[model samples]
Structure formats: structure tokens, C-alpha cells
Target chain A: MGIAWFVVLSAFIFCIGAAGVLTRRNPLVILLCLELMLNAGNLALLSFARAYGNGDGQVFALIVMVVAACEVVIGLGLIVAMYRNKLAIDADEMSGLRG
Target chain B: MIFEQILFFVAAAGAIGGAVGVVVLRNPFFSVLALVGHLLALAVLFLLLRAEFVAAAQVVVYAGAVMVLYVFVVAYIGGIEEPIGPSAGPLRVLGPLFAGVLLVEIAIATIGSGLRAVSSTGPAVADDFGSPEAIGALLLQKFLIAFEAASFLLLIAAVAAVVLAQRRRGLEEAGGETPLQIGRRPPTGPQAEDPAAAGSGGPAGRAIDERTPTVAQGS
Candidate 1:
């Protein structure tokens, strides 16, 4: 298929992830959706790399993966800390910062 | 050419299915598992695009280490699941509606102009175009600073995760006893000598006698 097909697929996946983030109250599920979004971006990057015939996109994708890993780690750690503090785990209930 | 197209479609199906599963599943544990499947499918897509090293990293880092952490956290949280349906009123309808609009907008943008800059069949490439050696060379040459920065970021993330997950001593008392500590109190007076007698005791004695079998059994 053409690169357009790949880009469209990436967009589709990203939208699915966005919907998940918006709809899901569970922080863990939200994180999972974030992962989906990141992966979709990676797919698009790889497709562009293939289209241009180079390794730069691959390298960029690798760095994105590292950053994604860090994000997931910090997110899960926050969730654990919240749980430990006996705070309600629901995203809706995490309003301690609300003015 | 036809084979490649078929493979792409299959992997795309897998990726979309897993993404949907992650969103639709109520249980966070199941959601984590679904994400694992999604990551694996993305790895296949990476391979289809000739990003061999990235595909391997996708499987190893995303599907392997990241998903494992997600699964562990889900398990630790126990049976807690997302409440049925959206927790907020507008979210029930607005969420999907907005997402649909986003999809249409993105699709139009993608189809209209995103691929116009590149040739459909792509440019010719060397055998090592996306190989580990080529990527390594690119990292050392053009992207050395970024590579080093990524490593530094990872180190910070590791330290941060450890610190964030650790229970702060002050908060433990401030938040009151955790579920594990709710019923158990310290051994004092007769209970100090006799583990059977539950104590109206000091926190220090409670800490000391925490492992005592009778105290464990009583709690």
C-alpha cells in the first residue's frame, strides 16, 4: 500500500487512544491509551522513514521509545503512590489540586 | 508487493483490535494485557517498514518491560475496576463524539497532503538502511547529543520511579494506617509479655511485635 494508507492507520489508532483517554476514568487505562497514541506516532515515523529511505526516522523512533518508557514509569509510580496514600484511584476523584 | 500489503493489513487489524480492547475492557488488568498485544502488533508493523532494530526494541522495551510494569501495578491495585460507563455525565456522549471528529479531521489531513511530499514506492536504500549498525552510526554522528540526553532521561526516570513509589514516612502517619495496618495495634502491658492480649500500646511496640504470630492471627 501507499504511505497514505499507513498514515491513515496511524491517525485512526491515535484517535482511538484519544477517545480512551477522554472516556476512561481509570488512570491506569488512561496510561494504556497514552501508550497507544505513542505507538501510533512511532508507526507514522517509521512509515516516513521508509518513504524517504533513511535511518534517521528509526533513530528518532528509538528515542521516542525511551521517552515513552520514562513516561510510563513515572505515571505508574504516581498511581502506586496515590494508592498507598489511600486516595481514591479514580481520575475523577483526584481533585486535590482543584481550586 | 501483494504479500507486503496483506501483511500490513493483518498487522493493522491486530493493532486496531488490541487498541479497541484496551479502551473497551473495564478491568485494568485486562487493559494492560490488551496493550501488550497492541505493542506486539506495532512491532510487526515496524518490521514491515524495514525498521528491524526498532521492531526488536518495540517488542523488548514496550511489550516486555513496560507491559510487565503495567501488569504488576494492576495486580497490586487488586480487584479495582473502572466504574461502568463514563464516570462523568457529558463524557458518556461527548468523548466518543469528539474522538470521531478528530478521526475525520486527521484522516482528511493525512489523505490530502501528508504523503504528497514522498514518492509512493519510496526511495532506494542500502541493505543496512535500518540495521542496528546504520542506526548506531547515525546516533554517534548526527544524533549523539540526543542519544546521550535520552540515556540521561532514562536514568532520571528510574530514580524518579523509585522515589515516587516509595511510601513517605510522614505521609504514612498523616494518611493514617494503611489497609494492612487498620486492625492491628501495638502489644503493651500484659500483651507485651503475652502476645495473645491485644495491646493499647505504643507505635514502637507495634512495630516491634508486627511479626508476632498471635498478633498476626488476631488482626
Candidate 2:
């Protein structure tokens, strides 16, 4: 397959993740979708790296993985704290700061 | 060539299907399982792209470590069996519409470009293009600062997560309040003020009372 196919596939996965973020009420599931989006970006980076015959994109993808790991760590910590305070895991129910 | 193409298609199908499952599944546990499938498929795709090191890291980091953390949090928060409430009103329609628009826009841009015709015709990669040795050399040589920064970031995240999740005895003993409960107000309004109506009075107060003793003992 061509590089275009990879790009399109990445885009499709990213959009699915975005939709999940917008629609899902559970913060844990939203975090999972975010991971999906980050993985899609890594796939696109790897495909471009192959297309260019360079290793830079691969290194960049590796760095993205590091950042993703860090994000999940902090995100899950916050979610746990939120669950402790609210006794509910729904994103919509945690709107105490909305006003 | 044909075998590679077929493998790519299979991996692509698995990735897309798993991504859909992650979004559509109600149970967070099932969503996390779908994410594992998605991550594994992405690893295969990385392999097809010749990023061997990245493929291995994908399986190790995203599929294994990250998934374990996700599942742990889901279980900790008692959310494994909780059904996600449906999106209300315009959000139900707007979310899908926005995603569809984004997909169509990307499709048009991709198709309009000449990228489809560009096969994998780049110069032959080095013998160690995606090997662990090559990646390590690049990380320690050209990208040393970035690599160090990533390590530093991870350390900071680890420390911060511990602080965020730790329950402080002093804070709880001061006014029988946890740190997060310091400035929070009791629920207002008519239904929320009733003590006899337990369910209507909000569960936060009860939850805090139930958790304090266990957390104190654990700490």
C-alpha cells in the first residue's frame, strides 16, 4: 500500500478517538480514546519515516510514546482523585467548577 | 510484495475495528481491552513500516504498561461495570457530525495529493535503520538532550502522581477534611439539603466518610 493509505487510516483512527472524547461520559474511557489518538499519530509518523528513508520520524514517535506515558500517569492520578471526591466517575457530573 | 500488502490490510482492519470498539463499548474494562487490540495492531503496522524498535516499544509501552495503568485506574474507581450515560441533546448529534466532517476533509486532502502514487521508493535504509542499536545511537548522540528531557519528564510525572494520589493524615485530621475537601461546599438546594433522603443528598459526604478510615489505616 501507498503512504497515502497509511495517512488516511491514521486520520480515520484519530477521528474515531475524537468522537469518543466528545461523546463518552466516563473519564477513563475518554483517556483510552486519547491514547488511541496518540497511537494514530505515531503510526503516521512511522509511515512518513519510511517514506523518507530517515530515522528521525521513528525517534520522534518514540518521544511521543514517552510523553503519552507521562500523560496517562498524571491523567489517571487526577481521575482517581476526582473519583475520590465525587463518588461518581461521569465527566458530566464533575462540573462543579463550571460556573 | 503482495504478502506485505495483505498484512497491512489485515492490520489496518484490526486497528480500525478496535478503535471503533473502544468508542462504542459502554464498559470501561471492555474499552480498555479494545485499546489493547488497537495498540497491538498499531505495533504490527509499525513493523510493516520497518520501525522495528518502535513496534516493540508500542507493544511494551502502550499495549502493556499503559493498558495496565488504565485497567488499574478503572478498577480503583469502581468503574469497570458502570455504564456510561448517553450524551444529551445536541452533543449526541454534533459529536458524530464533527467527526464525519473531519474524516471527509482528511480524505479529500489525501486524495487530492499525489501521495497515492508514491510507493515505498525511498532510498534503501541503512542495515540498522530500525534496530535497537541504531535507535540507541541516535538517542545518545544526536538526540541526547531530548532523551534526557523525556527521562526527566517521566520522573516528574511519577513524583507528581504519587503526591496527587497520596492521602495526607494531617490534612484529614485537621478538620476531618482531605486536601481536596478543604474549600468544597456541601450540596445546596432543596433536594440536596435533606438528610433523611440519603440518595438525594449527594454521595460525596458518605463516600468521604467511608474512605477516611481505610485510607488512614493503609497509610
Candidate 3:
């Protein structure tokens, strides 16, 4: 396997994640797909880091992890707030601005 | 060498399978678990790529803390499966199609580039290249600003999560008692003070209530 293999794998995972985000109605699943996409990016970053013999990509991956955690935190909080308000859990039902 | 190859293949398979499972699983809870598997597999890949510190972080932060939050949220949300909506008709078909096209495009772009000339063995580096100490030095030296910014982002996110999940005052006024006030509180202390404050709080609370749905929809 060359660098291309890992890059291809990363792309494959990203595409899977994008499909999930597009197809899924559940916000939780959409968030999971977002994580998937981020991780795929991390994989590509690490692979390139490996190829280039540097630590910048690893550091970037660490920052990406922090951002991912923060995103999940805010997203789940929103979901909980939505649930508390007795709103419909489905994403489509919550679109109040649909003109 | 052969063992490393086998390990890479195994981790790759696990990662892909778990990603598929996350999307395919109907139960949100199951999806969360599948994501944990995916993260673990990615950690292994990270290790294989010589990102030892990053691998550890992936296991600890992404797989551990983040996934725990996901699990708790899924449980709290009652793991309700999404019913396919009317608008989902075309999207269900088009989503995978577009994603497949994207995959092909990315693959061709990356593989057909000069990156194809690069070998899998990669370049040689110091023995401590991806060790924790090395990455830590980079974090504190080269990437100190970003590291600090990340910590600040985490802090803001923590505060935002708490504020966002706070029980709305409108619901409290409507229910005549706060959710936390029922059964969990002393019978006489806060309960007696509640009605005295209700009238004074109603309009302001309703104003917040009118704003609440907009914030909720912002997600």
C-alpha cells in the first residue's frame, strides 16, 4: 500500500459519512456522520504526516479532536433542549422557516 | 512487515465496517456504539501511521469522552428512530449516489496525482518522531496558539452546552412547577416562594419562550 491507498481509504470513509449526513433524518446520526467525516480527515492528515516525516499533521489532528468534542457537546445539548421543549424529534418537522 | 500489513488491513476493514454500521443502524444507540468501534479502528490506523500520541488522543478523547457523550445523549433522547419523511424520497436515493461520485472523484484526484509516486514505507524519522514528548513540544512551541485556542473553544462549548440544555422558564410556568422542583425539592422552602415569583416572571419568561424555538431550530 502506498500513500495513495490511505488517501483513497480516507476518501471512501468521507463519502460514507457524507452519505449518512445526507440520507439520515436524525440529528444524532447526522452528528455521528460529522464525526465520521472528521475522522476521515484525520486519517488523511496522519497519512500525509507519515509520508512527509513531520508532526504538524498530528498536532492538527489533536486540534481537530478538540473541535469534534466541542461540536458534539453543543449538538447534543441542542438535541436535549429540543426534546425538553416537546418539539418533534424529526428534523423535517422542525423547519419553521420553510417558505 | 507482513504482520504490519495484516494489521493495517484489519484496522482498515474494521474502520470501514464500523462507518457503514453507524449509517445503517436504525437505533441511535447502536449507531453510537458503531462509532466507538470506528474510532478505535482509526486509533489503530493512527498508530500504524506512527502517530502514537495522536492515536492515544483518538482513543481517549474521541472514542472515550465524545462517544460517552453520544451514548448519554442517545439514552436521554430515548433512542427514537427517525421516521422517513416525505421529503426524504429523492434524497434517500440521491445521497448515496452523490457520495459514491464524490468518493470516485477524490480517489482519482489523490491517486492520480504525484502522491502516487510516494511509497507506503514513507520517509525515515527519529525514533521519537511521534512520541508524546515530541508532539507536546510541537504543541507548546510551534502550535501553542492553536493549542490554547482549542482549550478556549472547549471551555466555551462546555458553557454553551449547559446554557442550551437549561429547562426553559416557559415550560416551568406552564407546568406550575419546575421539573427539578418536583419530588427532588424540599416540600416547603422553594415551593412556597415559587408562586410569588410567577406573576413577576411570566412576560419575561414568555419573551424568552418566543425566542426559544428559534434557538432550538438553529441546530
lDDT of 3 by residue, A9-71 (tens): 899899999999988888889999999999999999989989889899989988988898899
TM-score of each: 0.82, 0.81, 0.82
Give lDDT tens digits, candidate 1, residues B1-219.
Answer: 899999989999999999999999988888888888888888888887889999998898889988888888988988476676754588788988999999999877776774564438577778888898999999999999999999999999999987786657666676675654555543234554675444443345445555465465567
- Model 2, B1-219: lDDT tens digits are 899889999999999999999999978888999999988998998888889999999898788888998888877776556454443768878888899999899788777766633354445677788999989999999999999999999999999998887754344576565554643434322223443443444465556654444444435
Q: Candidate 1 chain B: minimum summed lDDT over ten consecutive residues — where?
A: B196-205
Off-target runs (Cα >4 Å) in candidate 1 are B117-119, B170-219
Query: Which of the CAPRI classes, incorrect, acceptable, medium or high, describes model 1?
Result: medium
Number of the top lDDT candidate? 1
**For the second chain of model 2, what is the TM-score against the true structure's chain B?**
0.73
Tell me which residue pairs clash in candidate 1: none
Docking quality (DockQ) of candidate 3: 0.70
Better of 2 and 3 by lDDT: 3
A27 in model 3: Cα distance from truth in Å?
0.5
Ordering by TM-score: 1, 3, 2
TM-score of 3: 0.82
